[model samples]
Target: MTTKTRAAEIDALLKELYPRAEIALRFESDFQLLVAVILSAQTTDVSVNKVTPVLFDRFPDARALAGADPAEVEEIVHPTGFFRNKTKNIIGAAQRIVAEYDGRVPDTMEDLLTLPGVARKTANIVLYNAFGKAEGIAVDTHVFRLAHRLGYSSEKDANKVERDLMALFPREEWGALTYRLIEHGRAICDAKRPICGQCALADLCPSAFTVNGWREQA
Candidate 1:
């Protein structure tokens, strides 16, 4: 099938499978989301969720987090792994928000990336979920795998994959599309053993049902 046809099929399947996809990380405000997204790097959302409640309780807002001791923050987030670095990024991000953005998380991609540990993935999540802006695709591991499997993009690097996805999909769909792909990846198209037979997008997935499909299979 052509790329356009495959893209259309994948989009339709995603809408059907996850019509109301959303950010899995639990948070109340933009500031909270910004911190959660930062902590979420190289960590599971489940682990991040477990840590954030305690962390947020101790340091509820930007000002509170900004004033927090790095060691204490690290202790609280230890279970998430890379606690020291996560703490540094969280505190540094909060401090920047307080100092420059007046304690408000910036809604734009350019401004969001100014904070430490805020890469394109984190920025995309914050901008799309927190600010309702669709500046780019959030190409997490799930997105990276699914996009290639479904023949939406041929790029191996996340940044290139994100760029290709942003170019292929409509701007309005970009925000929710990544979330849906993530959900699908977790539930069906897993990295080790994707349930391709049960996958809604199997028909369009070029990598479906193959041993070495979409990168080396475990």
Candidate 2:
């Protein structure tokens, strides 16, 4: 099958496997979602979620977080790892949003990128989830791993992998595909010990049954 057809088939199976797939981060507003996404860098969504309830409770909005003391914010977000930098970025981002964006998370990728700690991956997630705009795909660790394993792209850069995926899937499906791929990665296609035998896409996956040899010891 052609790459496009193969990609569609993979997406079809993923959509079925995770029909209700959604971003696992818990947030009630765009600002909160932005904070949660930044906090999620190199950290699990579950871990970020655990700290955000307390983080948001104290610094409820961009205006509030903009003026928060670094030490206090550090204490609250310490569990997410890289606390020092994460605190700095989130607080700086909040300050910028309040000072320039008028306390609202910028909807456009350009405007979003101007903020501290916001990159294309984070911008894509915020744009899609917060505003339902699919300008691009968010390539997290899972997406990067899955893209190569599934024969979608050979690029080492996440942005290049995202571009390859965008060429294959419809724009509207871009956001949804990310969630489903991440869900599949976390659920079955683990980086260390993928449960390939139970993966619904094993029949179609090029790397299937090849990388899970380490699972025998588990």
Which of the numbered candidates is closest to the native, going by highest TM-score?
2
lDDT (Cα, tens digit) per residue for candidate 1, span 47-112: 999989999999999999999989899999999989899899999999999999999999888999
- Expressed as tens digits, the lDDT of each residue in 1-218 for candidate 2 is 99899899989988888989999999999999999999999999999999999999999899999999999999999999999999999999999998898899999999999989999999999999999999999999999999998999999988899999999999889989999999999999889878887877877888874675633433
Runs in model 1 with CA error above 4 Å?
Answer: 212-218
Candidate 2: residue pairs that collide: none
Q: RMSD for each model, in Å, please?
A: 2.9, 2.4
Stretches of model 2 off by over 4 angstroms after superposition: 213-218
- What 10-residue stretch in candidate 1 is worst by lDDT? 209-218
Per-model TM values vs. the true structure: 0.94, 0.96
| Cα deviation of 119, candidate 1, in Å | 0.7
Candidate 2 has what TM-score? 0.96
